[model samples]
Target: MNEKTNRIGILPIGKVPEIVPQSIAAHISGCLDLPAIILPSLKNIAGCYNENRFQYDVGKTLQTLESIKFKDIDKIIGVSTVDLYIPIFAYVFGEAKQGGKAAVVSLYRLEKDTHGKKQPSSIVLERAAKVMLHELGHLYNLFHCADEHCLMHFSGGLQDLDASPLYFCRYCSKYFLDARSKS
Candidate 1:
């Protein structure tokens, strides 16, 4: 495999809106400066749902995405409409294994208000892009940054996620560039 080609695949799992993945692909190229393509839509998320929490398990989602072999693709970012949760947290906008091949971002909560009301598409798209970039940073082995302005900063809620910038900080940008070069 040619590691030099760091192409990213944006996959929609379950009933994700078409615009969501399209916007994510655009963000990948425009902000991250990497080539991104949208993959075919997947219909089932069978084992991801937790009957108790009523939320999808993020670990299981990543595992499902990793199980698929995307030829010539260096990394994949699965976008889902379902709410995602890790056992440790109430919910997570996204999840990725450090330096791993696959990551996922959920648009479920991003489009909704604190009261569960829907927000405008523009706001939702912005939130999803932020989450995708943050998760992608983890895929590159970048850790959470203390700098609030960085895209790698951990967002505890929608407000925090909203406050985060779409680009990485200087320190993280250096690390990202270093990691990309080694790829």
Candidate 2:
């Protein structure tokens, strides 16, 4: 594989509106300075909930992925809501085939406000961007960072998500550049 030939394909799974995927893809491409292409959504990819109704369905996710043409892509990034399950991650890895390079950025709405109110913060947009960049970093083989302010930090909740910076730390930046070199 000539490193220069790597391409990142952004697929919008399920019934998400077209604009949503395009917006997310643009942000990721801007952050990484890479070309991002949005793939058509696959039918039969309806969102589902678990037995506990926790919101997840691996089977449908895998089926959707199998329907796509992944031949030309060196990496794939899926953009969807938190309703998506961990199995979606499994599907990505399974398709990526260990070192094949693929990842998914599942967007979750922040459940709180800065003042502790139940209201969603206007910062949710920023949070979404951070999540997109963070996952893209993983696709490039970057890991969690010790810098709590960096985008690569593990954000468990709304507070942690708001606390993390939108920009990557120095080490993460270097890793991103190295990945770009391979592409």
Candidate 3:
């Protein structure tokens, strides 16, 4: 899809800070050249909490996100403050299905460093934007990059996430462009 046809929606899930989704929307327009709008906040994350892990399941959260309908939105990125995890991974900054219409990003881990130090507001915002865009890449069918500098690189923890850039590598950039074109 061309820039005109691809409109992204940022849906704040649960109790997310207002600025968080605003930042993601700004980054989507400034970095990706796509129109992005913040949708109304949804206070739902109820059925996704896992009793065993004490963390929200990414698959279930995403399933919940996919169930929501937003008119005129081609894709959606759900932002939340809760911790999210997949069955295989201990935690994830964000999660998405390949080429799917919806994705989710969690701010629980991004607020602190690997050493558990609280980060500055700027740092937290930057990390949040990076994860948002990275998951959006997956929504467009872009995979994890071998290049560590790319935003598409899998960030297993805070340290790795800090080291990765906020933009894609050259090859991944080309792939992202192609993916957007075909979407």
Candidate 4:
């Protein structure tokens, strides 16, 4: 948890919403007390909605990581929507391995809140916080938790995301702390 030494890199896969990724990254870095580095603007990175097919290309993502020279990074986090057609988790793993990191975190919004009405609800921000922290927890080698209210709980829908708490459960906290100890 040494804020000065721990560097978290936020990479935009393609053209994503201007707010979501930055918001998520800031929230995560604040929670973990780590230095968050947002990468420079990218060109070839395509957005999920911008592509003809909904699929994400794992190989393409790996190529992007390679192009960026992954070795200089400590950890790279990718934010994308589930609708992007590609197996985002697979791409995450591919990139993580290519970068010589233990893991990478991927995030998707559970609710459809484009206009800031209806969908996301008031707790949308909290839900986003949960997703970022949950995925970051994975980077620390933490596993899913049985506690439905814990941030580590498996979320399948907006309700699931809403049901989960923003903070880790006691057991999960121990694992998170342990991971940081090693870091």
Please give, for residues 95-135, the per-residue lDDT of candidate 3 as tens digits: 89999989999899999886888999999999999999999
The residue-level lDDT of candidate 1 at 61 comes to 86
Q: Model 1: how far is 20 from its true place, Å? A: 0.9
Error of 3 at 77 (Å): 0.3
After superposition, candidate 1 runs with Cα above 4 Å error? 1-4
Candidate 4, pairs of clashing residues: 14-45, 54-84, 54-85, 55-85, 55-86, 56-86
Q: Rate the local accuracy (lDDT) of all candidates.
A: 0.90, 0.61, 0.90, 0.58
Off by over 4 Å in 2: 1-4, 44-49, 57-67, 87-100, 111-122
Output the TM-score of candidate 1: 0.95
- Compared with the true structure, the alpha-carbon lDDT of candidate 4 equals 0.58
lDDT of 4 by residue, 1-183 (tens): 555445667666556555656776777666766667777645544532325455556445544554564434566666544332235342221123321333223334444543434564335456655766776787777788999867887776566766777788999888888887786
Error of 1 at 116 (Å): 2.7
lDDT of 2: 0.61
Of the two candidates 3 and 4, the one with more favorable TM-score, higher being better, is 3
